[model samples]
Target: MSKTVFITGTSSGIGRETALYFSENRWNVIATMRHPESRKTGLEGRKNIDVIHLDVLDPDSIQQAVTHALTTYGSIDAVVNNAGYAAFGPFEASTPEAVRRQFHTNVEGLMDVTRALIPVFRRQGHGTIVNVTSMAGRMTFPLYSLYNSTKWAVEGFSEAVAFELRPFNIKVKIIEPGIINTSFYDRSKDVLSTKEITAYDTLVEKIIRYEEGNIKKGKFSPPSVVARTIYKAATDGSWKLRYHTGKYSGTILGLRRVLPERTFIGMMRYLTLR
Candidate 1:
């Protein structure tokens, strides 16, 4: 029987690419997103793929999606937690509501999805969990306080859970992708701001200009790169924990580890504002 993968946030970007990749590789794919009837990803009507509605913020939807996948496929080999959004800008500029939403969607949502699938995975006696985080999980940049915190939370959570899940023949993998060319650069990004906060305007402007300059020069990898990496992580069958993908992921991770804290902060400031 063909292996099955349940992936969240499959409406576009890495999620959509991963769903397609799995389908092409002959794996049954449960490609779920918040809006199934409103997406243009063409995941629907594809062989070996089922597009379903799954909003990470909706607990009932998470359960329903998992149930549907298990019912249709008998067992799921892996679950990819790819549903998340980023809130960027100064910490002070981020409203309490935005902060809550960021953590709820990126951190709690991932946990909720994983929690729902753990029982099924435990019952099946084997499974893989691939969490889609960003390089920001380990390496922080300016104007992404909330976003970085959320990814970092996923990183820590995945690391800690891997130990417990290993005995059940389940593997937890973290996909730390670097800058990728996707809707995340625009549509998926929430630029946090309030009318009262003009203090961060200059700093945020500098960071945005610097980042945009690099983006225009094509310094990022395509979403397919991360998708392919995810496929490898899910099927590698090793206890390996972290899989870095996309442009500059490995290099940046290395820098973050070896550089002094003060020096690293300076370097990031230079790279993000220069």
Candidate 2:
């Protein structure tokens, strides 16, 4: 029997790419997204792939998606928790709803999905969980307070859970992608702003200009690179905890470990916000 993988946020970007990669590799893919109907063009009628509706914020949707996957594939070998969004800009500028939504979707949502799948994996005697965290989880940059916080939460959660799940024959993996060319750069990211407060306008403008300048010249990895890393994590059969993808992910993470805290902060500021 072919192994099966369930992936979230498969409407586009890394999620979509992962689905395609696994399908091409002959693994049955339960490709799910909030609006699967909109993605029918390239995905529908494809072999070994089933597009389903799954919104991480919706518990019922999560359960239904998992149930459908099990029913269709008989067993789910792994799950890729790639459903998340980013909120950028000053923390003070963010609305209460936006802040809640950020954690709810990124942190709480990931937990909910994992919680739902744990029982199935436990019953099966083995499974793999690949979380799509970010380089921001271990490091930080200006203008991404909420997004960084969420990814940091995921990093800690995945690391801690790996120890607990190992005895159950289940592995938890974290994929930290640095900067990838995806809709996350635009459509999938929420940029927060406070209309009434202009105090931080200059700082925000400077940061945006600096970041944009780099992006124009940035050598971003394609989403396919991340998909390959995820595939490796799923099939490697090792309890290895973290996998870094994208351009300079390994270099940046290495520097974070060797450099003093203040020195790393200074370097990041000079390179990004200066």
Candidate 3:
């Protein structure tokens, strides 16, 4: 029987790309999203792909999607937790609700999904959990404190969990992508704002403008690169845990590892805030 993979956040971006890649490669794909109805026509024609409703924020949906996928394919070889968005801008301006929601979706939601599927993985005695974190998880940038925090959480969580899951024949992998050219910049990001506080306005504007310029220049890699990396993580049949993708992901991470803490911080401030 062909292997099956269950993925979340397939409405667009990395998740959509991953689903398509796996499907084209002949793996059965459980492509899930909050609005699966909207995707019916597009993915329904594909024999090996099943589009289903699964909002990470909804525990019921999580259980439902997992159950359906297992029954449909008889086995789930992997689960890709790729459903997350960013809450950007200055931290001080971020609302309490926004902060909570950010963690709810990025950190807590991913945790819930993993928790729901571990039993199935244990029963089968083997499975893979691929988390789509970000380069920001390891390195910080201006105006993305909260989003960075969530990715860091995922990174730390995955790293620690890998050791525990090792004996269970389950593997955890983290995919870190840097500056991917997805709808993420325009549609999937939320910028925090304090209506009356203008202290960080000019600085935030400059940072946003700089990022937009980089994206417009096509400096970021396409989501397919990350999808390919994810596929490798799924099928590599090794205990490897981290896969970095997109442009400058390795270089930035390498520099951060080798450079002095103060030197790196100073360099980032000069490049972004200057």
Per-model TM-score, in order, reads 0.98, 0.97, 0.97
Tell me how many clashing residue pairs each candidate has: 0, 0, 0
Candidate 1 shows a clash count of: 0
Tell me which residue pairs clash in candidate 3: none
Residue lDDT tens for model 3, 141-220: 99889999999999999999999999999999999998898878878898786577899889888898889788778889
Q: Which ranges in model 2 have alpha carbons more than 4 Å from their true place?
A: none
lDDT of 1: 0.92
Worst 10 residues of 3 by lDDT: 36-45
lDDT tens readout by residue for model 1, 1-274: 8999999999989999999999999999999999998787888898899999999999999999988998898999999999888888889887889999999999999999999999999999999999999889998888888999999999999999998999999999999999888888789999876568888888888988877887999998999999999999999888899999999899989888999988888988787776
**How high a TM-score does candidate 1 get?**
0.98
Error of 1 at 10 (Å): 0.5
What's the true lDDT of residue 132 in model 1? 95
Candidate 1: the clashing residue pairs are none
Alpha carbon deviation, residue 111, candidate 3 (Å) = 0.6
- Predictions in order: lDDT: 0.92, 0.91, 0.91
